[model samples]
Target: MEKYDYEQLVICQDKESGLKAIIAIHDTTLGPALGGTRMWTYASEGAAIEDALRLAKGMTYKNAAAGLNLGGGKTVIIGDPKKDKNEAMFRAFGRYIQGLNGRYITAEDVGTTVEDMDIIHEETNYVAGISPAFGSSGNPSPVTAYGVYKGIKASAKEVFGTDILAGKKVAIQGVGSVAYTLCEYLHDEGAQLIVTDINEEAVQRAVDAFGARAVGLDEIYSVDCDIYAPCALGATLNDQTIPKLNAKIVAGAANNQLELDKHGDLLHQKGILYAPDFVINAGGVINIADELNGYNRERAMKHVDKIYDNLETVFAISKRDNIPTYIAAERMAEERIASLRNSRSTFLQNEHHVISRR
Candidate 1:
């Protein structure tokens, strides 16, 4: 293992905003780190740290798997985006990025919106997910959903031997941006949809838009469907929930779906085809990563549309290696990132001496 793999991750916290930000520049070989700026009210600094580190690492694998020329890094603002965000707080975050120079780039994710990125942009040049006016491809959730749609097709092929998507029952666990878009795709495919979300408005939107059956958050584990897609949060399926899943496949835009490492094996044992969360949901990152140069909305979309190919490769690798699909996908992505880092070691600082570079 590379020393980078074991290196202590760097993080900067702003006390005034109670922002416990982390920059897990998983690999800087390709370029400065680029990921999202997700704002959430974590219970504690320790919880925030855990989330930032895990999410940053997932970004690394996501970009690598998508073959993007960027690294993985993420920031977590410890406040409610709906009510707690202010200009001063974002500006403070910008200062943190400025201090890091160009090593870690930030964008919008989960709790944070594109408008938030615009605020962060005021403080530093190291920001993506800026508004369209700022010459950025904003709100990558739709593209992320596109990738998940394609991935669902690939998973369908592996499990059902077809990607036609029609008549497939897909239970979406969240009606957020990406999941909503995924529902749109599934709706077009004539898939029977079951959707759930903590947000009532989002659930109603699903009801109005696609006639998706609204399931309660507590009942998600019991939904009888061909595919149980957990798009809301991570670790939706664990020891208890996994046993209750009637879905033959589990794939969605949620990050770090496995609560623990052992959960991967649990899914494998249950014969449920699992597409790694980061791999399937990488469409958004792939799109934003495209904006570093000339913004080509069409070209960026084409890259995202290629999620089918990635899904196929992951599925094939899983079968060929007789390993869990999630592990197979992660290994594939890790190997690709390792290769890129090795190729660029001569140009980057501290890269040659420390393989544990993350």
Candidate 2:
């Protein structure tokens, strides 16, 4: 907890359901912690806890950067989603969330689904991304993709002095659901696309739909392009790959694109305008957060569109502070949280004074 300044960490278990999970709350200065629950077959208990803590901290920054009145938390179930899932397990998990008394809110994430969230909802009203019938926001991928698209445009404007994507070459590192939708938007803008994926079918789909050129997985990093979008996995911007990048900008849907803080610094040194992953990929969280206020699609979309403006702000801070964009993003979030923390402290002191007078 001291390493990351975590707020809380809970270990939950249910023998009957074979449920073993870790919930980590990293911050709540802005508001209650909101993040998704991920189920994975972690190698060890410690690994699961570490993942939960790291992800929770990332959510704190992601939420604050997106301008959401929420903090960061995350849950990790130590099991295989494919073979270990059961209704009883999810209900048990939900009960654990209920025990938090609204300090942490969970939704669907990798190895989990809306159905799992719905099951969790049975035990706690604190869950988001449940079925739309329950007034929840459905699949956040499209909204996330839209935000990345807008972020890319903002980065383009910063680098090329215009946001027009027509005739620009883009290398997309994934053709998954979010990246596929992002391709549609970029294709419509006449951006030339070079794509790659581990799944040939997915790659073929992008090729057929967007007329994208398919390349080998390793070939993606060296592709000649104006922008490189790493939409697949995290840490693609490490020491090995950074030197191979031929793009002028890095913007995508992946979380934790930089393997380490120094890699972000390396990108900055190379003059690559990187749209910080947390800031650009905040649309999904922004989409689900709207559920707190009765789930308005238009309102959520308008909020997602602000990703462009958010990136603009990050860039401005980068220039003003002469720091990497990643550092600037962190500064922005920290400043917001610090301001709110001060105001809340004053409000509480004033309330205490009134009570003391009475």
Candidate 3:
């Protein structure tokens, strides 16, 4: 807890339902902690706790960078989403969240689905990403893709002096739901796509739909293109792949794109403009956050579109400080959080003064 400055960690278990979960709350200065519940088959309990804590901290930065009024938290359920899932497990988990009295909110994540979120919603009102029938935002993939698309254009504007993607070759490293939707946006803008994925069917879909050229997973990094989009997994922009990149711009929906902070510095030295992952991929969280205000697609999208301006700010900071974009992104989030903390402290002091006068 001291290492990460975590606020709280709750371990929940229900033997009858075979539910073992860990909820990590990283920060709550802005508001209630909000993040997704990820159900996965972990190697051990320690691994699950670590993952929850790390993800919770990431959500803190992602939410704050996106200008959301929420803090950061994450929940991890240790089990295979394919085989161990039961309504009883999620219901019990939801009860745990309810016991927190709205300190934490959960939505669907990696191994969880909307159906799972719907089940949890039955037990607690502190949930989002439920079915549209529940007056909640359904799927956040498309909105996330839109935000990434906008962020890519912002990165392009910074590096190439133009945001137009027409005729620019972009090597996309994944064709997952979010990346596939992003491809649609890029294709519509007349960008040439080079796509790769471990899933053959997904790659074929992109190739058929967008005329994207399919490449091997290992070959994607070295592909000659104007931009490289690592949409598959985190930490792909490490030493080996960084040396092979031919693109001038690096932008995608993947989290933790850099394996280490030094790699971000390396990119800076190499003159590659990078759009920070959390800021660029905040659309999903931003979408679910709108549920707190009574879900409105129009309003939510307008907020997600601000990702462009957010990246522009990060780039400006990078230029002003002569630092890496990743560092600049964290600086932006930290400044916002610090400003809010200072304002809240003043407000409390004034309130105490007024009471003392009374």
**CA displacement after TM-score superposition, residue 60 of candidate 3 (Å):** 0.6
Give lDDT for model 3: 0.95
Q: Report the Cα RMSD per candidate.
A: 4.3, 1.3, 1.2
- Against the true structure, what is each candidate's TM-score? 0.91, 0.97, 0.97
Error of 3 at 313 (Å): 0.4
lDDT of 2 at 152: 98
Q: Write the per-residue lDDT of candidate 2 for residues 175-219, one digit (tens) a residue.
A: 998999999999999999999999999999999999999999999
Clashes of 3: 0
Clashes of each: 9, 0, 0
Which ranking of candidates, highest TM-score first? 3, 2, 1
> Ten-residue segment with the worst summed lDDT in candidate 3?
254-263
lDDT of 1 at 285: 85
Lowest summed lDDT across 10 adjacent residues in model 2 is found at 135-144
lDDT of model 2 at residue 116? Answer: 93
**lDDT agreement of model 1 with the native:** 0.83
